[model samples]
Target: MASRRTALRPPLVSEPDLPDIVSPAAPRRSSDLRAAIIEVDGEADLAHSTLEQCVLSGSGSALDLDGATMMDVDVRDLRVAKVSARRSTLRRVRISGGRLGTLDLSDSGVHELELRDVRIDYLTLAGCKAVDVRVDSCRIAALDMPGATLSRVAFAATSSDEVDPRGMRAEHLDLRGLDALGFLDVTALRGATLTLRQVELLAPVFATAAGILISD
Candidate 1:
């Protein structure tokens, strides 16, 4: 019998029923946004802000949410060039149907987060501590996770052009559904699970790393 931990548990995200409408105002420090659409026209400094049960969607050149805390938030249909939430904390957040040039969440603590139907040029979670996260049906040009710690993370029906997981620590990380073109550090996937087709696809890369030559 397979252990419970062997299976990837989906993120427990509560859908937000937002009814309030918020004006396009620059968020102040420690702002509390609830049940509203937080739109960012240009750039908003959302550091130390708390957003609960709200929808955040907009088009902007840059949006920064460093050190912000979000719970039960829905981030939908955002067309941003650069979206950064470094060192932020997120729980029960769902980010879907977004097009972003760069999405950086370095050094953040993320729990029960789901990212689906998003297209990103660069998606990085470097040095992050994430649990119960899922990226489903997304297209990413580059996915970087150096020095990050991931638990019960899975990528379902996702595709990435490049993946760099150097020095990453993962437990119950399932990458069988990820169709990645390249991986920077294959050894960093020690504790992750991959399907036989993925293993066969990476066999040459593994052999190259081991300096093994097969000529038949």
Candidate 2:
């Protein structure tokens, strides 16, 4: 072996491929579920699919199903300019966080019509029938659900300022945290009953809205 002088060795070179940079955020509903039909409820088995012409908002609300992730998976909100559910089935659907400029849920059936954490401007539910519905923590200026049969409807912490609740009916009306129920016609609650606290809270506003005077 020839006498090898200690020579300075060059550093070894290493190479690695780079990964494609993609957004960490989840895919959009229009893109991810383009072909997949999703249910509103958190169930293991889904029976319905193919929700064409349906719009789902991508925001979860406080009034949502328990133990369900409304933020990512509970994406069944329709942000359409005008919604026409003429012959659609929206059962067990947890819809929240969207603007339904005008909604016509007529003749359509709703098993669990959950509208939690939504921003509803004007909604019309004429001839629309639903059961077991809840609208909690929502802000609505006006909502019309006339001619619609509702069973066990609970509206908790919802605000319907300047809304017409005259003819609106609910089996168990939970208007505890509501601010305004004055814009509605008092005749609407003719056949319905209310609680003492609700009556007390609404008395002044009711009298004021009707141009009446309330004294001690």
Candidate 3:
């Protein structure tokens, strides 16, 4: 007698592409800083430095924090050429109305960062950890955050040409009213939320990722 062959079975439940995100951070206030005209020179700890309508000029990381922290600061109209802050922390800081060349925050930790109405040429937060980061009404040329970890991040009414969030881990990502025209790695947005219009715009990308064939 001939034996019968058994057929293979498919998976009962498919695993989710995104990770399980936990609760986001609560809102917190920073200590009020006095208004002054402060300059960022060599390694320093800028605490309570409110330089509104001031120009912070530097050349290739002329100002280095070196594991320092900048807390409760408000910088408006920033004119920094290049700032390399890899081992610094920014807490409850607000920056607005400026044309920054490069603001490198790689391998750093930021909390309650708000960049509003600013135009950044190149911004990098790669391999960094941020909480409660909000970029509102800003125009960023390039925003690179590969391998970064974020929580409670929101980009409201922002425009960007290049946004690279590959290999990033984020929770509670709010991208409402974002007008992005450059390359958007949709596969990296597994745990992000989007509006209905955004879903419609990225339908083809999603279909391609799902291995679905669409015919006319």
Separate clash counts for every candidate: 0, 5, 0
What local distance difference test score does each model get? 0.86, 0.48, 0.63
Preferred candidate (lDDT higher): 1 or 3: 1
Better of 1 and 2 by TM-score: 1
lDDT by residue (30-67, candidate 3, tens digit) is 22223333544333333222222222322233444445
List candidate 1 stretches off by more than 4 Å.
1-26
Per-residue lDDT for 88-167 in model 1, tens only?
99988888997999999999999888899999999999999998888999999999999999888889899999999999
Local distance difference test, candidate 3: 0.63
Model 2 residue 126 distance off true place after TM-score fit, in angstroms: 1.9
Pairs with backbone N, CA or C atoms under 3 Å apart (clashes), candidate 3: none
Q: Which candidate wins on lDDT? A: 1
Between candidates 1 and 2, the one scoring higher on lDDT is 1
